[model samples]
Structure formats: structure tokens, C-alpha cells
Target: MSTFTENAPGVAEQSPEAAAGFTLNHSMLRVKDPERSLHFYTHVFGMRLLRKLDFPEMQFTLYFLTRLLPEDSVPEDPDERTVWTFSQRGLLELTHNWGTEDDPDFAYHNGNDAPQGFGHICFSVPNLESATTWFEDMGVEFVKRPGTGKMPNIAFVKDPDGYWIEIVQPDLTAGLGR
Candidate 1:
């Protein structure tokens, strides 16, 4: 019963200081199977499927996901391509462009864990140990364990498609200037 609105607030209304800070709103990924990726994200991370759009002409299916929370609500923005929003801390956008020319060679891996020109999406977790164990129990392969010396207690894990996800702790002391 969710609806899309064209009267959503602009960037200025959201955060005026971030207007010029080049903030990252969402990260898009091209997946071979939309349903498969959807299952991985929803089942493993407990993310809710906010909305899904089908473009018959373009042969594409866009899926939007967000962390579930009591205050989570969708925003309206007809001027932007953003399909959905969540009250969660961050946004996860899954793009499945179907019927296009074959993209069989698309791989999320870029050699090293952190490759130049490669972007890895990060998410904050309440407890690093619990999140790590949850993913491990779900058969997700981890790239590394939590490293303490770093700014944030971070651990890297790979998705079913081999995409990297940086799991970080929400402790403020773990970040810079602590």
C-alpha cells in the first residue's frame, strides 16, 4: 500500500551543510538475478524490501531496501530516480536491468579486498560479533575479521555475488577525533 510522491523535500531541506559535501545518498549495483540478490540482502541482513518497480519498456526491475525500524517511512520524490526510502540508518539500492545486451562478464570482485577505483558499500551494525556470526551462520564468506587499530572496528564480508560489504561498529570512539 506504499505510494510514491512528487513532493519530497530537496537536499537543501534535508541538510544544507551536506549540500556541498558530496554526500553519498545510495549505492547502486548491477546484479544478474534481482530475486536472488533480494533474498540475500533481505534474509541475511534483515533489510526490508521498500519498493520494487518494473520498467517494461526498459526491461528492468529496480528494488529498494532499507533497514527496518519503528519510525521508518517512505519519502516522496518525483523529481529524482530514487524509488524508495527507509527510516533506517542507510539505503541499499538494487538495480536489475534486464532484457539489455548480455552482461555476463560483470563481476563484483576487483582482485584485492580494497581495489583502486572499486567501491565497497559499508553498513553500521549494533554489535560486530553478532552481525559477523549471523552472516557466517548464513554461509556468507568473510573477507577479514574485525581490526581494532583502524578508525572503526571493521570487518569485511562478501555477498553471494562476490560484492564486498564493510561491516562497522557504531561505537563513536572507534571513529576519528575520539
Candidate 2:
């Protein structure tokens, strides 16, 4: 069986100096309905909308969101807000193509069916059990419930766009003795 090692054949080596100050800014997902997608993200995930940009010429819009801690401060100026939004980690970008919501047959491929490629995004919670219970109460759709799958502690929930959102506690692997 093939397994990955530190110096694996396909691994690209990077020095600390070369990779400094690099952070995952965001991962984007296309949504059909901005209203429903925004509601699900902000209400269900408790993420605040950081910025929204509209492109009339391109006929689409982009919504940037992030989960802000109580201590985090948001800039009031538009330019400063843009800078602040880009610097934060774990941002979610929702892209909406105009008029997709109006078409009854329109749907984005969720990457879970046949010919799959893109996978799920995850969120770490303080308590897995409580989070799953809260998700249940909020009428969120579950792709898999905790304790039912091979990895019993993890759960998968769907966003308004049907993209999977993995739910896990911070100590997930530690408890498994990995």
C-alpha cells in the first residue's frame, strides 16, 4: 500500500522563510440563491457578513463572511474593511451568478454525486454533541450524524446550497488516540 511520507515523491518542499505569513484566506462556493445562502451561513453558522461586492457588468455578486470572536473589531471605512476582511483566516466566499435563483432548473453541482471532485468544508466546535443537537433543532439537514458513521465523533451537515459542512470538535483525533 502506498502511504505519504515527509519526503514523498509528490510532496513539494517549502522552507519556513519561503512560506512565512501565508494563510488560507478563503474557499469559495457558488450558490443559486443569495438570500437563502446568506441566511443559512449567517444564522445557522453564526458567521457575520464582512463584505459584499456587486458586479453589474459581470452580472454576479460576492459575499464574504467570517466568524468573528467578541474581541475582534471591524473597521467602519470601506477600504479598511476590505483590508481587514482579506487578512482574517477561515473566510467563506459565496458567489452568486445573477438570475440563477429565478430559473427553476438551475442548480450547482455539489461535488458529492458521480464524477465528484470538490469536497466539504469543516468547522470546529467546542462541543460536538451539543453542536449536533443545536443543528438538529435549527432544522439543518444532516448528511451524516455523529455516532452513526465509522468516525463516530464527526458529523456532516449541508448548507443551503447542498454543499457539505463537516462538524468536528477540536480534540477529535486526540480522543481517538491518534
Q: Could you say which candidate leads in lDDT?
A: 2
Whole-model alpha-carbon lDDT for candidate 2: 0.90
Give Cα-based local distance difference scores for all models: 0.69, 0.90
Candidate 1 has its poorest 10 consecutive residues by lDDT at 79-88
Report the Cα RMSD per candidate.
8.8, 4.3
Q: How well does each candidate superpose onto the true structure, as a TM-score? A: 0.67, 0.90
At residue 150, what lDDT does model 2 achieve? 80
Candidate 2's TM-score: 0.90
lDDT of 2 by residue, 1-178 (tens): 2233567576755545667678899999999999999999898889999999899999999999999989999999988999999998889999999999999999998899778989899999999999998999999999999989688888999998789999989787575634
Q: Model 2: which ten-residue window has the lowest total lDDT?
A: 1-10
Query: Can you write out model 1's per-residue Cα lDDT over 70-136, one digit (the tens) per residue?
Result: 8745555532324335323356778787843256666655434555566578888889888878887
